[model samples]
Target: MNNKEPWLAVNLSMLFPGFGQLYSGKALKGYILITIEAALIVSTVALWVQGSLGGFLTGFGGSILLVWNLFDAHSSSRSGNEDSFETSRKAGKDAWLGIFLTRILPGLGHFYMGQAVRGCAVLVLYIAMNYALVLLSGSVAGAILGLAASIAYLAAACCLLYITEKNPLRYPLLHIKYFIAGMSIVTIITFSGALLVRTYIIQAYTLPTGSMEDTLLTGDHFIMEKLSYNNVDSTDPGRGIGHGDIIVFTPPGTPVQEHVKRCIAVPGDIVSIKNGEVFLNGAKLEEPYAKGETTYSGIEAGRIEGTVPQGKIVVLGDNRRNSLDSRGFGYVPVENVTGRVILLYWNTRQILKMDFSRIGKVR
Candidate 1:
């Protein structure tokens, strides 16, 4: 008769779908549930990356499945049925230890369970997945690949839990030593991968001021795509910064601070501001996004007359009166440009709630 703890079964499923069923000796049912969960996760992620509204709604379905899995696991454990995986449990294999080791690194739990071949395969697959994630980061393909890798890793852990010898009290202290070693390796690889992705692929930033009002607001959290700005080609406007694009960069005088502004004029363009209206190449420039007035006094007036120097661009904030942009600090070198703002994912204006409507493409 099954003598498993219901609480333990619930907790196992909490870690990942189907885990609790495996713990309850329902191996076939657990595997099927895991496969279903994986498919749901992957499809949801793929749809979200493609900017589909259905993906957002599908996420709620996944959450509902988790609740059902938890309930099923608890009920199965409480039924007192015969344990199907009794042989492994009687052999003194600690399922919890296997789960813990796999949490540290996908294949470590398999090694602990004496499945060396499967363990090696899991490790190799993990390494390859991470390498691919780094290469494809900041793109639609990257998002889908990252989700697939995560699902695969979790599935591998569930597999370990299913086959691992149970009864934690029988194992020696040697398992702890292996866990520590695996954790150290995983930590190094994880941090290095995150650093590479953040540095060369994408990075998150929060707007600190209403400089780009209406377009970007204070407390709006957004992601910037660094790949497009890396090794930019000045001659090809399509590959680099261009007129009307919102960019994050270090203002000319503020080397330590970053600012977000709209590129008003590019190199070789004659720029002049007459009574707050901008003129580019002797023609009136239309700016529907810009607000506020530009004062003709002091340094602001001096910026009114100039041909954008080579390798530099003129930038101005949408909220012109409140911003200290190229008008006050002069031209910004192209090298100071960091990245283009792509997605605004969150807003922190309300301390207790998020403004979901504010989340969308930066444009």
Candidate 2:
């Protein structure tokens, strides 16, 4: 009796690319779909990281596959024709369910497959590994750690899928109580991970104003890496903030808002403006990227500046005449800095008129 529900198959496929096919008794097709989806995803991610336009286009294929999978699962369920290669479902263990859960979180699939102790251990290890990687970000070591973590996650997922398919365990993973518990766990872990990544790894922000002008225009979307100045001595010019570096930080009076500006002078450097030209340590600073005419309107206007106080930095926007930076808000404390802008990945000026050339590293 083919008692499969079409909606149920569609829902399973929605959870993970081949899960619906597996539920509809097309295991061979399901496996093939999963492999193709995985390959597309990995390739897309890698290419995107390298700032390739092809990566952006490659994402369309994944979307197409997802839609097709959903439709196929629904049709297969409605037809009630089980493939000869379909494995017996008499065993309570579901390889598709295990793989889907693992896709959500590494150890979750093991728990669904009746390996409770192993799951718990793997869960703890996965959390610890992620924490360590976050701590190590922004260096060669961090890159290596991230790669190793990816490999480890892939290996664990593969092992869980294989074991669940071969073991035929009587785990009641589909029970309402267990399913709810699993979902709840996944929710908590996912939220925590997102928060951790945003706080310590990287974050995306859009420029709402043209304070940066030629360097960064209004409606430009860029990614800032939080790891560069994290836990490092800001006074050290070699390793910390340096001249001409663009940074994002909370202004002195504005705790709720962030401003992006170029670092003009670090601690111990004297800064002043003569006429409309900036002088750093008694020498006229040459700024080729600066836009518009400079005017003496900020708080530091016409003031004979002394050495920048320790743990402080002088910042100014590329659009000198239009910016409200350290000149208007005073020297920004090192602690207020959130991150350094690394790339301008997108422009939200208009949906149909996006400038693809702007998608590159920020100087």
Candidate 3:
């Protein structure tokens, strides 16, 4: 505490990964921490490219670095056996502010208290939990599980902030302006990111009609993959639209709502219907997903024949006889295709809509 400048080391380390140790004359330790931090940054980017779950690694690595630097800064700033820092020793940081900040954003208080790595880790876990909650949106078991996971995350985050702030090297986190700015920035980022992800990457929807029946029930909820047909990103690895794929698209005349149906015939293909059986390219199509023998006879009992026009495709409901689909509405334009239905996701029992099950995948 004899004025070796603990604040300088702490602040520098806070700014980067290992600046505190470097300033405190711990060159080797500083280099190691900085190297690890850099590696983690690279790893995080790679993980994001890999898949959704892998994206969590970046935050995980950053959090670890925060804790290491906090400890390093504290130990290095001490005058050691030389008695130089004896008089410069200071009091611990405010605990109440720690609680308030952590509660607001889970790990932000840790970041403010110089535990950057730990804070980042908490942020990652919190985000992952939120993703899980979104996926498990409509079931009672899912709600309970999501709520428990969130509470646990909150508790762990607050505890980390509390511990970091209580340390001997911690400083006051009571600046109103900084707190307000931090909270505002975080809220904006989180909300905007969520919106982008939901709109462009994936969106969830509940089936309002049993038109899809055997393939997708009335109470089923599914996630739509939005990246490919939108032509938003060329590097997107998802496949192009193919026959038999389930798609969520707008009917030719409907602009206010969307229709979900199976892609029965693509452009240039001839589609013909007879006796509840679909024929493609002059061959009777095999529809393993449809409940061919179970549907009622409301379907217009007639023979129809047509070739799908260029830039347009023909779609049909699984319950062929009972659905008002391409047979009634004409061709669906490719431009109207918004997203592909990739997963079944969730559903409830037909008799008792309250009973739920994770249907997982759609036909």
Model 2 error, position 179 (Å): 5.6
**Cα RMSD, each candidate:** 10.5, 11.5, 10.5
> With candidate 1 superimposed using the best TM-score fit, by how many Å does residue 230's alpha carbon deviate from the native?
1.2
lDDT, residue 348, candidate 2: 64
TM-scores, one per candidate: 0.59, 0.59, 0.53
Worst 10 residues of 2 by lDDT: 167-176
Q: What local lDDT does model 1 show for residue 213?
A: 88
- Alpha-carbon runs more than 4 Å astray in model 1: 1-174, 234-239, 350-355
Indicate which candidate wins on lDDT: 1
Q: In model 2, which regions exceed 4 Å deviation?
A: 1-6, 18-186, 231-239, 281-284, 302-306, 360-363
Superior by lDDT: candidate 1 or candidate 2: 1
Q: How well is each residue in 207-272 modelled by candidate 3, as lDDT tens digits? A: 889888877888787777776577544432222568888888888788757889888888778877
Clashes of 1: 2
**Cα lDDT of model 2 by residue, 1-363, tens digit:** 545645447646765688778878999999999999989877765554444556556678988999899889978876864543134453356655565577679889898889888888878888988998767754467666766666676566556545654432322335323333443454455456655666786677789888999989898888777776885764564348889988989988898688999998898898887778888989999999989655657365633367888888888899987898877778888888888887787776643575466676565
